[model samples]
Target chain A: MKLLAITSCPNGIAHTYMAAESLRKAAEALGVEIKVETQGSIGVENEFTPEEIEQADGIIIAADKAVDKSRFTGKKLIVTGVQDGIHKAPELIKRFESGDVDAYQGDGKSINEVKQERKQKQNPFYRHLMNGVSYMIPFVAVGGLLIALSLAIGGHPTDSGLQIPKDSVWKQIMDVGSAGFTFMVPILAGFIAMSIADRPGLAPGMIGGYIAANGSFYGSEAGAGFLGGILAGFVAGYIAKWIKTWKVPSVIQPIMPILVIPLLASILVASLFIFIVGAPIASLMDWLTAFLNGMQGASSIILALILGAMISFDMGGPVNKVAFLFGASMIGQGNVHIMGAIAAAIAVPPLGMGLATLLNKRKYEKAEQEAGKAALAMGLVGITEGAIPFAAKDPLRVIPSIMAGSMVASTIAMLGNVGNNVPHGGPIVAVLGAISHPLMYFIGIIAGVIVTALVVNLFKKNVA
Target chain B: MKLTELMDKSLVDIDLNGSSKNEVLDEMIEKLDQSGALKSKRKFRKTIEKREKEGSTGIGFKVAIPHGKSKAVTSPKVAFGLSRTGVDWNSVDGEPARLVFMIAVPEESAGNEHLKILQMLSIKLMDEQFRTELLQVQTVDEAYELLDQIG
Candidate 1:
C-alpha cells in the first residue's frame, strides 16, 4: 500500500522532522511505501507530486498548524496533531488499515463554512442597530422626560389639547425637549451607519435620516420617524461601502475616502428619499387617512384594532400619523371615543417594552437593559416612540408583539366608552382629567402593557 | 561541509547531571554556548522555550529533540546528552526521556545542505539499535564518535 502524510508544527523546527521520521519508520515496518512531506523551518521539503497524490490509498495530516487540506478533497484523510504523528504513528496507520477514516471535503464553501458565515453575518445587523440605539436613548429620555414634566407641572388642558402657555419657562423646556426629539432620528441613523461603514457613512446616513423624519421633503404632512431612520441608515451605509470598493484612479484614490465617497453616497440616498420612496409613502398616508375616515362608520371594534395596529406598527411613522390625525379630527366633531381608544393604544408600545426588560433581563444586552428602564418612564407619560429602539433591532419579533398589545388596549378602551378630548394619549392624559372613565383607561393601558411585555419576551431570543 | 563539522568533543555529555527537563536544557545550552555555536545564549534559549511551549519536544521512546532557529545562532550545531537516570520530559509516551538532542540553527541560514544533514540526524535517532547503542556510550568522546557517523 502506498500512502501520504504531511507533518507540521508551529515552530517547524524539530517536532516536524521528528514526526516525519517516526511516520516513515512506522510505514517501513508496516511494509507500505509512504511519502512524508516535511514542512519545517527550511520550508516545504519532499512535497508530493500530483501523480503520487492520485496514486495514494489514503492520506494522513499530522499537523498542529493549519494544513490546507483543499488539495486532498476526495481522499481518505486522517487529521491529527504533530504529537500524535510522533507517538501514535502506528495507531494512526492502523486506523487506515482497518478502513476507519473518511474522505475529506475542505473547500471553504462547504456546509460548515456556510453555517459559520450565517452566524457571523446575522448578528451584525442588530449590532449596528444597537450602536444607533445606544446613541438615541439619551435623546429620547431627555425629550420624553422634559415634555412629560413640562406638561405635568406647567400645562393646562384646552379645546386645542395639552399646551404649555407660549411665554412660560415650561414652554422653553418643552421646546428644548422638542429639539432633542428632532435630533433623535438623525443621530440614530448616523451612528448606525458609522457602525456599518465607519466614519464615511455618518453624514449620508444622518442626511437621509433627516429627510425621512421630515414629511415636507416629500409633500406629506407627517414625517417618517424611527423606522425610516433605520432604513436610511442601512441604505446610506451600504452605498458608502459599495462606493469604497470602486476601482478609481490613483490620483482620485487619495480624495476618494474623505471627499468623494461621502458626498456621492449622501446625495444618492437623499435623492432616493425625496424622489422615489417618499412619494409612494405620502400617497399611502393619504389613502390611509381616507380609509380611517371611512372606518369611522364601521364597527368600533374593527376601528379600534386598525387604529391600534397603525399606531404600534411604525410607532411614529406616516401610518401612525394618519391614525393620530384621524383621532384628533374626530374630537372636534364631538366623537371623542375614537381618540380615547387611540390614546390607550399609543402608550402600550413603550410600557410593554419596559415591562419586557423587567420580565426577562437575559434577552437584552446591557445598553438595552438601561434603555428599557428609560422606556418605562416614557411609557408612563405615553411616548410610543420609546419602543422604537427595541423594534428597530428585532422588528420581526417586536413589531407584531407591540401591535397585538395595542389592538387589545384600544379595543378595551372603546368597549369602556373612554373619551379623551385631548389630542395626546397615555396615562398622563387620563391623570390630567382629559379622559372620561379614567379607571377604565388605566385598565386598558395596563392590559396592553402586559400583553406587549409577555408576547415580546416570548418571541425574543436571549442576548448573544 | 559535513555533519561532523557541526559537532565536537565539547558538545557531547555521556552522563548528564541534570535530573529534570529544564535543568538538562540549561546544561546542554551551556555546552552549545561554550562550543561557540551561539551569538546570544538568551535569544537562542527564548526560541527553544517558545518551540517547547508549542508542544514538548520530548517525543516517545525515551527521546527528546529540543531545537531552535534564530538570529542568535552563529552556526548550525547539535548538543547531545544522555541521562543515566531519565529526566521527566512530559513525553507523548509518558516515559521519562533519557536521550536529548538540542539543535541550533541560524535564522538566515546560508547552508541548506547543513539543514538536510540535521534532518538525517533526526531520522537516524529513531532507529532502535542506534538509540540502544547511544545509551551504552561510556564517555563524551565515545558519544561524539557515535554521533559523528550520523550524517
Candidate 2:
C-alpha cells in the first residue's frame, strides 16, 4: 500500500517534474500512499526519509540516465524510462502489486554497468543522439564566444575581411579559439559512439571524425565537416558494436573492448569515409555553397526562410545543428551572409517567448512569467535552449510562434545584406563587432520579436 | 497557531452522513455554524461554493480542503468531517474525497492568516502516517490529539 518513486531525465528539467507529478496523481487515484522524489535541474526535492523508505512496500526508479539503486537493496524495485512514469504509472504500480519486480541486489558494479542493463529498454538512436548533443553544446558555446571576443578586441576591418594583427596576444587568443573549433567535430563523434557502444567506441569515433574533417585524407579541397563527422560516428559506433558481438576466446574477452573492437572499428570507419562517403558529400557541399552564392533577392529570401524554420524547429536539435554547421563552414570559406541571417534567427524563439509574456501577462502563469525573465537573459546571450522550457510545456503554440518569428528576422537580415564575420549569433555578438550593418540586424530582431509576441498572445488564453 | 486551537470538538464530525460533495460541504458548515464560528450559514455556504468554482479544493489522498474568506466568519476556524463512503469533489486525481476540512476566515484577517493556516495544514497532510492515524481516530478527542501535532 505504501510506495516510493524517483524520477529524473538527462536535462533534469521538464520531463523530470512532469513524471513526478504524473506518478503522484496516479497514486492518489489508486488510493495508495506514495511519496515521490524528483531529481531535476534545480536539484533534489521532496526527498524520502529513511523511515519512509523502511516502511515502503516498493520503489520505482524512472529515469533516462543512471540512478544508484544500492540503497534499495532487498526492496521490490522497478527500473524503467521516465516516459513510463508519466504515461504508465498505474500499470507500473499494478506490476509492483502483482509482485513482478525483482528485489534490488547491491552488486558492486560501476554506474555504467547499471546503465547498460537498462539500455535495452530505450531507443538507442535517440539516447545516443541526445548524449552526443549534450556533450557537443559546451564546445560550440565556448569556441564561438572566444572567437567573437578575439575579433572584437584585436581585429581591424578591411576590404577582404576582419583581420587580426600577426604576433599579437589577440592573434594567440584567436588561435586558441580555433583550436576549440578543431576539436568540436571529433568530440561530438566520439561521444555519440561512446553512447552507442560504451568506452570501446571512443578511440575509433574520434579517429574517424578527424579523418572526415581533414581534406588530405580524401580527394576534396573542403573537408566534409560536421555532416561527415555524424556519418563517421554512426559508422564507428555500429562497427564497434558488431565487433563486440563476436565470440572471441575467453582469454581475449577482457581485452577485446580496449583493443580488438577499437582497432577494427577505426579501420572500417576510416575506409568508408575516405573511399565512399567523403568525396560525394564534399561535392554536394560545394554544389550547395555555389547554389547559395548564386541566389538572388527572392531565392535568397526562400533560403533564409528554410534556415529560420530549421533553427527554431527543435531549438537545439539535429535540424538546428545542420543549419549551424552550414553557416560555420561558410565562415571558413569567407562567406558571412548565410551566418548573418542565421544569427538573427537564433535569438527569435527565446526573445519572442519572453516578449509574449511581457506583452500579455494574463496569458501566462506565475512560473511562466519568471521563466520569461530567464529566457530574455538567455536570448541576449544567444542560447536558444532557453526557449526549450516553453516549447516543452506547449509545443504546438510555442513552436509555430517561434518559427514564424525566426523566419521574419532571417528574411529581413538577408534582404538588408547583413553579414556576421563570426560563427555565433545574437545581439551580443553584433555588439562585439562580429556583425556588419548592426542597425539593420537590430531592426530585424525587434520586428521578429514583436510579431511573435502579438501572434502568440492572440492565440493563448488567459491562465488561472 | 496549532490546529487544535482553531478546531472545535463540536465541529469535528467523526461519521458524516453525505453521499455527494455538496451534501458533505453543507454537513461540515452546519458544524461550524453550531460552534458560532460562522455568522450566516447561507452566506458562508455561498462563499465556499464560489471558491470551489475557481478550482476544486480536493488536495487528493481522499481529502477535500474547502476554504473561504468572508464577512460571514467572525474569526478564523477549521471544521473537520469524515465521510467513510467518500464524495466526489472532482479532484485532480479523479478520486472521491473522504476526509474534509472546511476553513473559514474573517475578511479583515484573511490575507495572512488564511494562507498561513492552509500552508500549515497542507504540509502536515502530506505526511501519510499522520493521515493514516487521523483516519483511524474513533473519538473527537482522539482526532483532535492527532491534528494537534501539526503547528
Candidate 3:
C-alpha cells in the first residue's frame, strides 16, 4: 500500500515543519508505507512519482494555505488544515486503515489555484478591506508600543492628560510612534486596494483612506476612522478593477494602466468619498464618539459589555476588528478613555487562556500548555490573536469566558478614568506610558484575566 | 539486529519498472505478496495507506521507508529494493528515491518492531561507506549480505 501527504503553513515557517515532523514520527510508529512532500517557504520537497500514486491508498493534505491537488486524482484524499494534521495524525491514520477515505479527484488545481479561484470569486470590496487590515496590524503594533513605552517612562500627569516634556527623548519616541500611527489608515487602505486592483488601486485607496481618516477632506473633525479605510479600500479596488476591465483600443491599452486607469479611479474614488461615503460615515462616527463620551455611570457598563463582546466574539475576526476600529477612532478624537477600555479588553483573552493552561495543565495537551506561555506573553504585548487557536478549537466556552473577562476589565477601566493615547490594548501598553492611570489599568487587566482563566477552567473539560 | 532476521529474502526486488509513487507502491506490495510476506493484498494496502495518511515515511537522502502495521503482515520484516533510475517516493528533500525500504510489522508488536527497524536503518544509513557499498551491489544477495554485515 502506498500513500501521499503534503504539509504546509501560512508563513511556510515553523508550524509547517513542526506538523510535518509530528506526522512523520506518527506514521513511522504506525508502521505504514507513506510518502510525504513538504511545501515549505523554500519550495516543494520530495515530489511523488506517477508509479507511487497508482499503488497508493490515500492522500493527506495538511496545510494552512492551499496546496495543489491535481496529482491525487482517484486516490483517497483527506483534506484538513495544518493543526488538524498535528493533533489528529493518529486518528486520521486509523480512519484510513478503516478504508473510509474517498478518492480525491484532481481538478488540475493546487491549493494556490483554489485560492486564486476563491479570490476571483470574492467581493472586491471585502478583498481590499482584508488586504488593508493585514498590512495595518504591524504598524499599529509598532506605533502603539513605542508610544506606550514613551508615556510610561517620560509622562507626567497634566490637566490635558499624560504629558511628556517636549525636550525629552521619551517625547521624541512618542512623536515617532505617532508618525507611524498616522500612516496606519492610509497604509491599510492602500494595501487593500493594491491586493484588489494591483498597483493602480494603491494611490486611490490611500487617498480614500486619508480622506476617511481625516474628516477635513469631507468637512468633519472626526474622520470616518478605520471604517472609512474599509470603504476606501473597497471603492478603490472595484473602481480600479472596473477601469481595467473596460474595452479600449488595442493601441491605447499600453497607456491605460499607467495614465487612464489610475487617474480615472483615483478621481472617481476620491469624489465618491468626498460626496457620498464620507459625510454619513463621519456623522455616524460622531454619534458613536458622542455616545462613548457621554457614557459616565451605568452607560459605561453597557459600553464595556458591548466592547468586550466585540473583542472576544471572533478572537480577532470581524467583530474584533470593529471594536478595535472604534477604539482607534476614539484615539484620533483625543478621547483616550475608549482606547483604555479597549486595552483592558484586549489583554483578557490571552491572559485568561494562559492562566487556564497554567492552572489546569490536565485540561490541555502538551502543545497547548506550551502555546499558553506564548499567548500570555503576547497578551502582555497587546496581541489579541494569541487566543485565536484556543478559540477556534472551542469557541462556545472560550468566547464567553474571554468576553466576560474583557467586559469586567473594560468597565473597570472606564470607571477608573483610565485613558490611553494610543489605539492598542494590553497591560504592556498601559505600563509603557500610552495609558493614564497605569496602575489601575494594570489592576483591571489582571482582574479580568483572572476571571477569564477561572471561567474557562470551570467550563473546559480535561481532554488530555 | 541480523539483517536476515529483519529482511525476508524473497521480498527483495532487483528491478523496478514503475516510476511513479503509486506504481512503485503497487510493485513493492506485489513483490511482498509474491514472497508470501503479505497475507491479504487489500488489507496490506489499507494498512500502508493508513500509515501514509498519517504521514510520509520519506526521510531525506535518496532513501524512502514505507512501512505499516497490519494483520496482513506475517512477520516484522524489511524489504530492500533498488531503483537506479530514481523512483519518486516523495522524499523529504524532494529527491527521487533510489533505495526503497518497505517495512511490515504485526499490529500487536507494531511500536517496538517499528522503532527497532527504524533505529537500525537510520544508524546504517548514516554511514557513507555502508550506503556506497549497498548502492554498488547489483544483486539481491549482495545487498542482503551488506545489510546482514551492517546489522
Candidate 4:
C-alpha cells in the first residue's frame, strides 16, 4: 500500500529529519512504498504532489507543531506527536495493516492544532511572500540569460540604449526574453495569492498584476511595478480567502471558488489598486529614479554597499531576493549600472571563501577543501549559495568576511561605471560581454575575492 | 570474497565464554590464527588493538565489528563469535556487544576485498530479522548457512 507522511517538530530540525529517516527505514524494512515530507528549519522538503496524495492508501502526520490537515481530508490518516514517528515508525505503519485507523473528516480541534494556530500566526506573510519569490526566480534566470545572450551577439550601442535590429533572429530571442520578463510580475502575484487562498486567489491576483503593470490603467506611467504587484497579491489573496468563509447555500458553494470568488476578488483588487495604491506607487518609482539618477560619488557608494550587504547577508534569503528583484526591475527601466554593482557583489562570497580554502589549507578539513573546488565553480556561474557550507559551519568568521568582500566589490563596480543589463552577476556575465567596463568588473571581482580570502584566513587559526 | 568462504567451522565460535572485550578479541584471533589465516598473530593482534583505540568497533545493537588490515596478515578472513554474557566495548549506545564479527586482511588486500566483506556484512547486519536468526542458530554449520545467504 502506498503511504504518505509528514514529519515535523517544534524546533524544525533534528527531530523532524530523524522522524523522516526513521519512517523511511521502517517502510523499507516492511517492503512498503512511502513518501515522506519534512518540514524543518529549511522549510518544507520532499513535499507530496496532488497525485501522490490522491493515490495514497493512508497518511501519517507525526508532528508536535500544527500542520495544515485541510488537504488530507477523505484520506485514512493518523495524527500523532513526532516522537511516535522516530521510535514507533514501524508500529505507526502497521496501524494501517490492522485496519484500525479511520478516514479523516474535515474539521477537528486538538492540542496540536491549538499550538499550530499560535505558531501559524507568526510568519504567514513570510510564507506567502516566499511562495511568490520562489515562483518568480526561474522567470528571472531564463529571461535574464536569454537577454544577456541576445545583447552580446546582436546588440549595438545606439541613442535609444542597447538595441537589436528589427526582424533579426537575435531580436526574436530578445523578444522571447521580454515576453518571459512580462510574466514575472503577474506570476509572482498569482502564486502569492495561490499560497494564501489556493486556486481561487489566482485570477484576481493576475488581473490585479496586469493592471499594476500597465501605466494607462492608473493615469500614470511606470504603473506601480513589482511593489504594486506584491500589494495586489496580498490584498486579492486575503479578499478571496475571506470570501471562501461566507457560508453560502449548498448549490452556490460548488461554484463559489470558480465563479463568485474570482469575479468579486478581481473587482475588489482592481478598484483598490487603481483608486488607492497605484498612482502613489508610480510617483514614488519616478521620484526614486530621479533620486538615483542624481546620485554621484559617495551617495551611490552607500547605495551599492547596502545592496551588496543585502545580497550576501542571507545568501538567497528574503533580504537577498529583495535586492535581486530591485536590480532586475532596474534593468527594464534602463538603469543597468545598479544591477552591475549587484552582479559584482553576488559572486564575491563563494569565490572569496573558495580562495580562502586554497590560500590557507591548514585551516580547513580535507572535505572542506573538496567543497571549496565546487564552491569556486558555483561562484563562476554566479550562485551565491556556494558559500553556505562555510557560513553554516562558522557564521561568525564567514559572514563578516563575505559581506566585506561583496561591499567592496559593489562599491568598485559602481565607481567604475560598470553596467550589467542582465540580472545575474559573476565572471560568467562579464565573460559573455553582458557587463560594461569588463576590465574594471574583472578587477573588482578579483579584489573582492582577495579581500575575503585574506579576512577569513586571518580570522581562522592555523591547524593544530 | 564471500564472508562464508572466508569463515568456516574452525573460524566460528558459537558460544564464547569471555566476558571482557580483550578476552573476546583474543579468543577470536586465536581461532583464526590456528586456521593459518594470519602469518603473525602478535602483529595482527596489535593492528586490531590499534584500530580499536581509534574508536571502539562496537556499533551498538549488541553487535561489534573489530577489523584490521595490516602487513601481519597473509589472507583476508572473518571470525564470528557469540557471547551469551555480553562484553563491554565502549559502544556509542553504551550497550555491551553480544555478537562480534572480527575481520583480518593483509595490507595488500585492504583496499578492495576488505571493504567488500564489510559492505556485504553490514547490509545483512542492518536487518534485525537476520541478526535474530543468526543469534538463534544451534551450531557452526547453521551460522555458516545463514552467512552464505548474505550475498
Each model's DockQ score:
0.13, 0.01, 0.01, 0.01
List iRMS (one decimal) for every candidate: 14.3, 24.5, 22.7, 24.1
Judged by DockQ cut-offs, the docking class of candidate 4 is incorrect
Clashing pairs in 2: none
Quote the RMSD, in angstroms, for model 2. Answer: 24.2
Across residues A95-158, which tens digit of lDDT does each residue of candidate 1 receive? 8899999988767555444444445345778778878888988888788778777877887887
What are the per-residue Cα lDDT tens digits for candidate 4 across A111-213? 3444344444446785676577667655654554566567667766442345689987999998897786677677778878888989999999888877876
Query: How much is the lDDT of residue A217 in candidate 3?
Result: 76
DockQ of 3: 0.01
Task: Report the TM-score of candidate 3, chain B only.
Answer: 0.86
For model 1 chain A, the run of ten residues with the poorest summed lDDT:
A111-120
Please list all clashing residue pairs in model 1, or write none if there are none. Answer: none
* Candidate 1 lDDT for residue A245: 65
**lDDT tens readout by residue for model 2, A213-250:** 77678776556656566667778998897887675544
- What lDDT would candidate 3 get against the real structure? 0.72
Candidate 3's residue-wise lDDT over A43-118, tens digit each? 5667666557667788899997888776666678999977666567777777799998887767766645444445
Judge candidate 4 against the unseen true structure and give its global Cα lDDT, from 0 to 1.
0.77
Off by over 4 Å in 3: A1-130, A289-300, A303-405, A412-443, A447-464, B1-151
Q: How close is candidate 4 to the true structure, as a TM-score?
A: 0.40
